[model samples]
Target: MPKLRLKESLAGLKKIKININFKKKEKQMPIPPPPPKPIPRGLKIIEKYPLYEPFSHVVIVQNPKTGEHQYILDELQLDPLERGVYDRILEILLAEIESPKEEILDPRKFFAESAKKIVDKYRISLGWLPDVSWYKILYHAERDLVGFGKIDPLMRDPNIEDISCDGVNKPVYVWHRNYESIETNLQFPADEILDNTVVKL
Candidate 1:
């Protein structure tokens, strides 16, 4: 009877060892790492392209859970100091702009030249502006003066056909040729800005 009980205990111990070995083998198998999480509400960028060279770009993103595509404008982000300088330059340029003596054939080039002159004139007083800031400032000045301001990227996109905005603090939706209606990052945070944009439009 003692021998039988010892044999039974040894058999049970052997079974336990076999189970432990199985677990060890499982751990040895190469396990693929889990995919990294998407940020800012699970948005995964699928495609990116430049609309305006160097300064402005657009990204196509998909929501993993919803699989909805969105268009996001990515432009050079300007700090407060750069914005202040741009604002000052824009004000002076607007005041100094003169009507062309003849029909302006190349309006974009004309506005660009005017902006460059103002930037050069105030270069000393504005201190040393970084190259990125210079491009960004010039882009905004040209965009507002010659093209649409905040919605210039959307306006320039050949794929987009229509743009709609209900009111202030609302996301502007655009009709894309391929994606249909897509909500954009553009919105008027204040009434004054919206009014100004409307006047410009």
Candidate 2:
């Protein structure tokens, strides 16, 4: 009788194990849906201005509904000295433009010409120029000063309606036209630097 009872207990345990296995199979999560593809929109290239060099450009685009957008394609990263040179030239140009004058020169022409002249004069005065591309330096200076500073490209993006950053070392977030709110690649790693950049806008 005891052996028969033991056999019945073992059989009950086996049935419980089978029931748990079936429950586990029933509890799997459903597969998530795939992300949406980029929507096709008719875009017109209105104008393209060179940014830091020939490698990258600041493009002005018009959409089908007659909306303008700005895009920076393949940005040119600059060294510290080159950055300083750009800032210096921008300051000088802004001061010159602000000075009381009968007529204000077109920013596009003024910046392009000023950059060429300033860079040449600077190199001659220093007696030694860095192993850097002068045209690139001038191009960036003109764009930042005459057009838009650090956030010029971001501001021009019609897709991005609002821009915000939480803190230093944090990626800036934008309200993208397609993606909604998303983090951007742009960051100002330091608070002071971020403050200065915002001041420009």
lDDT of each: 0.63, 0.47
Across residues 1-201, which tens digit of lDDT does each residue of candidate 1 receive? 011000011111110000001111111112222222233667888877666555556878888899888888876656799889888877787777664666666666677777678778888888887766777777777777665567766666767777777777888777777788888777868665555555444
For model 1, the run of ten residues with the poorest summed lDDT: 14-23
Candidate 2 lDDT by residue in tens digits, 1-201: 011000011111110000001111112123221222222357665555442223343444456584644332445556676666666655655554432233344545544665566566666653444544455566466555544444545554545566776666766666655545655446666555555455443
User: Where in model 2 is the C-alpha error above 4 Å?
Assistant: 1-74, 79-108, 127-132, 143-148
lDDT of predicted model 1: 0.63
TM-score of each: 0.74, 0.49
What CA root-mean-square deviation does each model show from the true structure? 28.9, 27.6
Model 1, residue 34: distance off in Å is 29
